[model samples]
Target: MTQTTQTDRTTTGAIPVPARTGVHELDPAEAQSAREVALRLVATAGAVVDDEKWISAAAAAWQELPLSLRHAVRAFRRHSGSRGTLLLRGLPVAVDELPATPGHGSSVQRRATVPAALIMAVASGLGDPIAFAPEKSGAMVQDVVPVAGREEFQGNAGSVRLSYHNENAFHPHRPDYVLLICLRPDHDRIAGTSTACVREVLPLLSPAGREALHAAEFTTAAPPSFGAGGERAGAHAVLTGPASDPDLRVDLAATRPLTARAERALSELADVFETVGRTEVLTTGDLVIVDNRVAVHGRSRFTPRYDGSDRWLQRTFVAADLRRSRSHRADDGHVLI
Candidate 1:
């Protein structure tokens, strides 16, 4: 892994910033073991990825995975480490068996597949998988692929550089963990997923900046991904919890500062994030998990051919404690209204 203390100005805009890369690769034997579990899951009867019964089966299959994989995921659930990100390489994705990257917008994986099985199993290890009704039609497994006519859009369908943000930052019941699995890379393999953790940015913040960010002086609106008609978050602190290690809750593209000092603080926070952020170019079978409570994530710009070979990634959101959001979910279902 690489580290830089110098501040980077390019990241203040949409340009990609130089970043440290770290990954935990599974051995051939371990990867094969995971593949076996995924194959069995694919063969299960009524293997719909989003159905409550299927989700329960996936959760049960979690215990059948390799011991190493289960241990690593459980440990991450307890503590996300200093970077608040974990990249697991060599998962059981059968690239040759996959279909063409979805060309339409709001693509989701409803049928069971090897990649879906792997992602859902991991989601069960972290927590129960959850989804918002307004986002991606409340699908448990959504496709993060570029779509035609949405190149400049800010959501998953766009190929442009996405700004740093906690997934669903405007929602009171935001995901505690965001899981993304790579099924295919972009034509150029240059598109990188980046993350910046508050643990690293906290130490670099000025006393005044920290004070301002801790106050309830920021408001965040819903992103384009959620469409329209959602309520915006009221005045809230960008950083919360203990000062030594605070949780981050602001989207650079949607969060607005309410006061002059708050504005300066927000700018300073962005700069510090740029200074410490890291980007990783994920490959097939790679799974990156972001601790949403402690870090903000984004993507670097990439040109999508719009052909059948565009980059393809599958995403799932996890709630560490599902019971906390019971009121928002109707009939104790996974989809939150």
Candidate 2:
């Protein structure tokens, strides 16, 4: 892993991509082991996906296990967690064959790939998982990669200039983890996903700045992408919750700090974001899990080629538990109907 430190203003906004070493790469055995564990956890999550009652029962049974098992269970979850992002190359890909159109209505569908079961399994391995899709949550993991019928590259969505961000940063229901499972790469394969650890940047701020970060000196709002159009919102406190286990609230475009100290901490936060964020390209069968609380994630720009096989990735949101967003979901672990 590469260590990160703050530099003068001249170096801000640039996160260097480090050369890969042997340890960060996963081999077949480790990949398979991860898959099997995810399968077990998903089967154990008590979810009614695909009308499979046994899987639901399986998930429930695992939940009954000893508490000590949780940590070990996550071993099968994310291997390198200090950075809060783990990369695995081989989990089963649901749509092994090409689809009639990227948006076909089957397991072989193109734009949206990856089995929902696997996502649930990974969530159980983490803590709690749920869908933001309305059909599942009211929001589909909306294909930003491939538009199914069209061959355009949809890596992150829209024409907006995307920067590092904590997804759903303001909402009380933000997921603790964001998993991106890749099925196809853009024609060029040059696009890279970027991420940075808050731990790395926390030390860059002045003592007073750090204090402001700990208090309710700031406010953030939903980005324009989530229908926040024409109107803007604000957030108080750059963060809330425990220091050890915290929930971050920030928006690069919308975040506002009340004092100079709070402003400095926010600046330090952005500096750390660009300094430490390591960009990793996603290839076929590559699955990356991001710790939403500890790190912010986004991607670099890639032009789409409107061909049949554009970049395709399956995205799923896991909250770690439904209680975190009780105002948005109903019981039985399903989103509000």
Candidate 3:
């Protein structure tokens, strides 16, 4: 793909260079403070790591971070430019004796580890941590690794190029943000996480295409991880909010158009993504937070050996407001049942 020049003004329906990806490199003191907070939370929650009480306690502890660090997070949360993705580097994570990639097995026992605790602390700063009842048996933190027999599957268990998607787009209560922390990178370090935002590509769309996207003529089916409830989202618009700067919600892998015009519009959107998307290769101690409402994310193809040392990334989801899904959960719990 050819690269477009960086400019605020549009030139013949082309996408300008997007605002750079948001990245914050933690200083030694800030990294140490984060480690201390994670350790304190681990000590506080002795037996149960996923307990709602314990998670809430961790969020409260996260609020006590230094004002400068807190301000940076707040600013990113409110306005992360056109990319809608943020990467935090140099966070302290204990990875010694880390278990091999679990494939499709249980991750319950791994939740009590120091890395998991650290993820919770950082995720809480963005929003309330959440989980889907059907994914990984409702575990808040999930392991993203290639499975033994599911290499071609489109979901997290595959090494194939996973198409761009808004996390959990088939559900009524999709996450507002998605977090992925790297403990071990792919063996060859060739895997890349791809992200694209409508804000960066809106100018590239024709008026007819934009009009078709705003109409409710598309549907997205839930991924296999969601189990029996993996049905299609009915009659939804791909774009919403202001016409000048719209929000996006469409899974290129699972979504389908109801009409020929909608199909053409969807293809145009994909073309823009191919030209404007940014890809990143995450390494150890790197945490990436994606604004799900504004950006769509996907993964590139990589060879996973499954030799207990393959690519391993821990993922967690968050919602800006938990109360919206109050009725879907029981007793104000974190998981949506």
Q: Count of backbone clashes for each model? A: 0, 25, 0
Candidate 1 achieves a global lDDT of 0.91
Candidate 1 wrongly placed segments (more than 4 Å): 1-22
| Tens-digit lDDT string for candidate 2 (144-211) | 45333432222254212357777767666667778776767777877687787666666655667667
Question: Per-residue lDDT tens digits of candidate 3, residues 226-263?
Answer: 76556789999999889998889899988899999999
Candidate number with greatest TM-score = 1
What overall lDDT goes with each candidate model?
A: 0.91, 0.57, 0.82
154-242 in candidate 1: lDDT tens per residue? 88898899989999999999999999999999989999999999989998999999999999999999988889666799999999999
User: Which candidate number would show the highest lDDT if scored against the true structure?
Assistant: 1
List the candidate numbers ranked by lDDT, top first: 1, 3, 2
Each prediction's TM-score against the native? 0.93, 0.69, 0.90
Q: What C-alpha root-mean-square deviation, in Å, does candidate 2 show against the real structure?
A: 11.7
